[model samples]
Target: MKIYFANGLFALADRMFNEVVVDKIRKMDSNIEVYLPQENGDINDKMNYADSIKIAQEDNKELLSSDLIVAILDGDTMDDGVASEIGLAYGKEIPIIGVYTDLRQHGVENPEKLKAVGSIGENPFAYINNYTIGLIKMNGIVVNNIDSMLAEIRKYL
Candidate 1:
């Protein structure tokens, strides 16, 4: 299976996902091919107009070609880039596997939620972005570890 590991480029999301999930998945199946955006994308430090275009093109190409997308929903909320990739996968009818480890609640834009999260580290009512979480649930399962992800993949494949 071809898998797209989507996450933020600037943050250490790539490295974290690589260490926690990608390595194990690769070792588990010889036939599986994983595409990591931070590692495989053509983004440069300068990030000229052409370079940005190239990067987006490369990422989108990989996303479209992949059979599954394992989006890292790290940080307090889902990263914007990862959300965009998820949208692409949804449009293409590609299965999405959300890897969210941050127990912190997201979408704190609401005043009540922000107040709740202020008292506690995370709001129990909202664990992540509502739409993103709902979307993932609709297409695929959201897992906290590689084991669940593997199980879902096995069942799906």
Candidate 2:
């Protein structure tokens, strides 16, 4: 299946998605194609407006064809572009598997009291954005690690 590997470009998540998860996915199944946004060098904040539009179109095409999305929601909150991709995938009825393991970055309204309020089961994303996490849980499963993500894929797919 084609997996859209979405994540924030500003952080290490993009690199990890490519360097680590890509190889793992390949080993699991050589035929599983991964649509990595970072691999497309055209999409950049340094580019001109027209160029940015062009790149957005390119990314849109990738999302359109992806069979599923494995998003790394591992920053302060879900990256805006990644969130847009997830929304598109959801509208298309494409399955999204969100892998977010960070425990101390939950974006709670009341830092102390609501830190664990939005958690579902052991996924105490104590610092993750509530709406973002909720959206992920609504459309897909939130995995804490690569192993759990792989297991979920094996079972679901």
The model with the greatest TM-score is: 1
lDDT score for candidate 1 against the true structure: 0.76
Model 1 spans > 4 angstroms off: 12-16, 44-50, 104-126
How many pairs of residues collide in each model? Answer: 0, 7
lDDT of 1 by residue, 100-143 (tens): 76544345466877677667465555357878878888888798
The collision pairs in model 1 are none
For model 2, how big is the CA root-mean-square deviation?
A: 5.8
lDDT of 2 by residue, 54-125 (tens): 977998898889877888777666678888887788878778888887766445455654655556554333
Candidate 2 TM-score to native: 0.75
TM-score for candidate 1:
0.77
Worst 10 residues of 1 by lDDT: 41-50
Clashes in candidate 1: how many?
0
